[model samples]
Target: MPIIRVTSLSEPGLEVYGSLTERQLKSFYDDLGGLFIAESPKVIKVALDAGYEPVSVLCEEKHIEGDAKDIIRRSGDIPVYIGERDLLASLTGYTLTRGVLCAMRRKPTVSIADVCRDAHRVAVINGVVDNTNIGAIFRSAAALGIDAVVVTSNSCDPLNRRSVRVSMGTVFLVPWTWSDDYQQELNALGFKTVAMALTDKSVAIDDERLKAENKLAIIMGTEGDGLPQYAIDAADYVARIPMSYNVDSLNVAAASAVAFWELRNR
Candidate 1:
């Protein structure tokens, strides 16, 4: 429990918590490994529970003995950097929520086959660049019984700072991996693809036929453009959520929640 008082924003060991960009922090330990900053005690706890190694922690002085106590105890011997409230806020460029953050080591990337090997229900995040939506989808997937999540290379990283916080840490709870050829790999794994898209031939999300499938993969697309033509064409069924008020579609995150809940295995 080495506690370091951070007197200045430029303090040598505080880079990961303040100065470094997400990409820089990601590559911080490249030769040894990569790192990600987890904000809030709750999210940090979840990451720890998921076996993500901790590098260090930053805390506001008040929280050192408050919300951050348990995190400090769980952190073992890692350096716990503490600073006055205003100083920390200035350093982080925002007010700390629950007043704590942790720098965690990223795990090795898993393959699509590894993630979907025995998955009964999966979700594919295809090129969804918005971190908030990506996080929300993972949160929904976890809540609604999705076994795993596969994000295409172009999609936002589930471990992105905002995504992790927005998901309330479910990103760590769910098994996920990157996929270059998501469709081909899912098909090879024996999953019937259900693209969440609007098309003439699309079926209702709650169609009984969807629930009848042995293994299902729900494919979700970007915010503005929706699923690509190839993805729609490749899917066994293109499904749409029934809407009211003349709404044509739901936000990707909202639609994902509905689709996940509706198509979840009984």
Candidate 2:
């Protein structure tokens, strides 16, 4: 492996970790959809185990013999950028957690049909812009037995560095893809759409009718406004989590966990 000790923050190959914008990292000046940075050893390992091709690795010098050792070995002969803790902090413009990050090639995404082909339960993420929420939802979906995830084009990138780290790499464990017209897409694939909204006509999330569907697509909205009117209108059912103490609604992330657990395929 090419273990290059970084001498300066402006080093040629260091841009992928910090200097570049998320879009730039994603496109990386190519047609291939781009790359994503997988932070921390655990997340990076999950990405590698899922067969994501590693472009490079950036890690603290101390971890070279500790947390990052196996990553270097397992990542084949890819470029391994090593630096001191303080310098590494400067590279990202802050002191980041976990001491290691891997820039992995974002493989071509599968079609919505491909991802949901055999899925009995799927989460359709609407315009949720919070990276943390996106990651949390994926973690819950993976743990609670959701079959797949379909993210709207307007939603936050699930593979964004912070999201991937927050998800502890569960993002890789779940099959997923982006959709432009998700309601139409899911319906076309024979999924019964269930939009999580606060409409007057909405049903309780645990409604036995929802669980009866052979293929269920649980649709979630954005952080603030919730799902758009058109999205709710297109769904087969509108549902809400019954709350306590006058709490109007839960955060999209928390609601997803509750909904996934309650409506999970039995």
* Most TM-score-accurate candidate: 2
lDDT of each: 0.91, 0.90
Tens digit of per-residue lDDT, candidate 2, span 151-255 = 988989999987898888999999999987777888888999999999899999889999999999999999899999999898899999988899999999999
Structural similarity to truth (TM-score) of each candidate:
0.96, 0.97
Clashes of each: 0, 1
Model 1 lDDT-worst window of ten: 25-34
Residue 222 Cα positional deviation in candidate 1, in Å, after optimal superposition: 0.8
Check candidate 2 and list the clashing pairs: 26-34
Residue-level lDDT for 82 in candidate 2: 90
Off by over 4 Å in 1: none
